[model samples]
Target chain A: MKAKVIVKLKEGVLDPQGQAIQQLLAQRGYSQIADVRVGKLVEFELENVTPIEGEAMLAEIADKLLANPIIESYRIESQ
Target chain B: MSIAVITFPGSNCDRDCLHVLQNVIGAPARFVFHKETDLGDCTGVLVPGGFSYGDYLRAGALAKISPIMPAIHRFADAGGPVLGICNGFQILCEVGLLPGALMLNRNLRFISRWVDLRVENSDTLFTRHLWQDQIVRMPIAHAEGNFTVEPETIAKIVAKQQIVFKYAGPVREDSPDGNPNGSTLSIAGIVNEAGNVMGMMPHPDRASEAILGSTDGIPIFRAFAEAAQEKSRLEYSY
Candidate 1:
């Protein structure tokens, strides 16, 4: 089994890296950029756990380690 | 007692911090590896800077859970002095020992230069030697140092005087110290609610010597050394 966690900076937190990329694209004639927010995807390989167990553990991992609640949020997708 | 300069894998500033403690401040210090579970006979904990865990996931995220961290927590719980500089600061925040999180610099660039910081709260054991609102300069080298916190938390930080230093004075855009990192309230350093732990983005250890261009960093280290020594003495006095 496998699992994934998508971590994103909170809605109002400044995403400077994303903004820089958005600006870079604008310079290359890519217009109509409303907003660019950056985030990270973490893929994990799970062993011998049912999908429910995997999701439960992933939630704890995301809450405790993968994402910092202060500035970021994480959503887990189990497969 | 000695200051335990924590060395996570890839920590580049551990030596600098050790130098400041052992040589400059005349305080005993030793290196404690991240894999170690005990902090040994140390009264002070110094979490130095560098790209720990290669800044993966987040700057200080992985290093926060290092084996040595639980000992640090125990030490901190006993009112021990724990100072985190640069990457160390991020680790403290990641571990929830301090409030706020450092995000990418607002300009999307790695800033490495001196920053003008005004001492905000001199009451902490970390900042006792410095006076309130005294402007000091220290080298800040980092990419993700723009500290942020929830809106409601800012009020508590201000009210409780958790903020220890703030970027202030005239900031020039064309100078070597140009480009502010956009930290909330311009905070450069902060102490926890108990004032036992402190975290700051700048390198005070790098500035502890006069020949390094400024002696302002001495007072900060000196204050912590004295405080840590006092705490150790208190523990043994019983």
Candidate 2:
């Protein structure tokens, strides 16, 4: 089983990098840019793990390693 | 009065914080590496500023996931006093210990200079020694220090008096030209919901000694020490 984690700044949190990119695009003559927000994606491969087990393990990872939980929120999905 | 300053990779102000606590304030302070999970017997933890993890990914993105952060969360949960300065503040926000996020400077530039900050609330452990509406000069250095939060949350923060510090004078009130990073609400520092943890963009440790051109930062640290001592005495009396 492979799990993917998508982490992003929670809504209402300012994203400086995204704002910078938007400005650069506008300066380059791309005037239609509406907004940009940057996020991180992490993919992990787990073998012989059930969905329940994977969720429990992923929660631990979120708590200890993956997300800061303060400014960023994360979602996990298996494919 | 045992204080511990957490040192992450690229943390330049760790020594400054330790020096202020140990030498200037005469408190027992130690440097705790980012890998150490145990905070030992320290009553207060200082997360000093600097480009932790080289400010890669985000200002405090990588450093927020450090091994010691779990311990930090535990420390805050136990009602221990924690102060996050500059990049340390960013990290605290990144780790969800504090509210809001630090965005890029509204001017789109790196800011490195001294600015005036008005103490908004003097009731916090980090500000109890200072008078309300007092102004102090402190240095801020960062590419991303703009604080942003939802309007509704901002109202709640104001209603709860969680705002600890704000950019003061015309320089901070007049946004864009006056504000360094275009922080929403001109907020520079704020305490957590519990009021025990604080994260601020200004470097108070840098202002602690007279040799640094100002001793205004003394009261902030002294407040922490006093609060910690008072808490300890209460714990022992029980």
Candidate 3:
């Protein structure tokens, strides 16, 4: 089974890299872009687990490893 | 006094820290690998910088979960001083030894240069020898040295005098030339509530020698050595 974790900076935290991308795109004439919040996506394969167990285990792993509770949040999805 | 510099897999500045502590400061300094569960006879620990775990997951995330962290945490809990520099600072905050988090520079650039810092509170064990508001030059080389915390936490830190250093230049907070990473209130370094742990972005070890362009960093190492020696003496005497 495969899993994907989407890690995002928690709201209210400044996303400098995301802001830079927004500025760069605006300068390149992509005027409609309102904002960009940069984040990370991690993918991995789990061994011999059903989707239900994978979901539960991934949630725990995300809280403990994939995301820092202080600055980031994570969403785990089956891929 | 004996100090240990904890070396993670990618810690590039461990040797610089050891050199300063052992050769420049005249304290016995040694390395403690990340996998070691014991800090040995070390009275103080220095978390030096590099791309620990290649800055994967987060700048210091992987290193925070290393086997050595629990030992360091216990050491700090027992009132042992722990100094974290650059990536080490990130790890300290990640592990909750210190409050706040370091974010990417607002300009999204890897900053590597010297900047003047104003000593905020000189009453702590780390800065007791330095006078408050004194300006010191230190080199900061980091991409994620921008510090942030909740407004409430910031207020409490200020009230409790946990802030130790700030940028010193015209319009300190707004001037990129001063606040190199756009840190909150120009904060460059801070101590924990217990005053036993400190996390700072500047590389003091890099600036400890005159040949490296400044001796401003020497006072920091000296202060740590002095504190460690005093603590050890007190323990042995009792």
Top TM-score model: 1
For residues A1-79, what per-residue lDDT tens digits would candidate 1 score against the true structure?
Answer: 8989999988888888888989988888888886788899999999989999999999998998999999999898876
- Tell me the TM-score of each prediction against the true structure: 0.95, 0.82, 0.93
lDDT of 1 by residue, B132-225 (tens): 9898988999999999999999999999999999887446763324337878878889999999999999899878888998888899899988
Candidate 1 deviant stretches above 4 angstroms? B174-179, B233-238
Q: Candidate 2's residue-wise lDDT over B1-238, tens digit each? A: 4777999999999999888887888877789899998777777788989999998767887887788888888878878888999999999888878887787787778988888888899998899889999998888888889988767778888999999989874454435345678887889999998999999998888898888888888999888777665565234211
User: Which structure among the candidates has the greatest DockQ?
Assistant: 1
Tell me the tens digit of each residue's lDDT in model 3 across B34-153: 999988778888999898999987889888789998899888888888899999999999889999988888777898888888999999888887888999888889999999898889
lDDT of 3 by residue, A1-79 (tens): 9989999999998898888889999999998999999899989799989999999998987886778887888888796
Which residue pairs show collisions in model 2? A70-B96
Please report the TM-score between candidate 3 and the true structure.
0.93
- Deviation of model 2 at B15, angstroms: 0.3
Of 1 and 3, the candidate ahead on TM-score is 1
Scanning candidate 3 chain B in windows of ten residues, the lowest lDDT window is B229-238
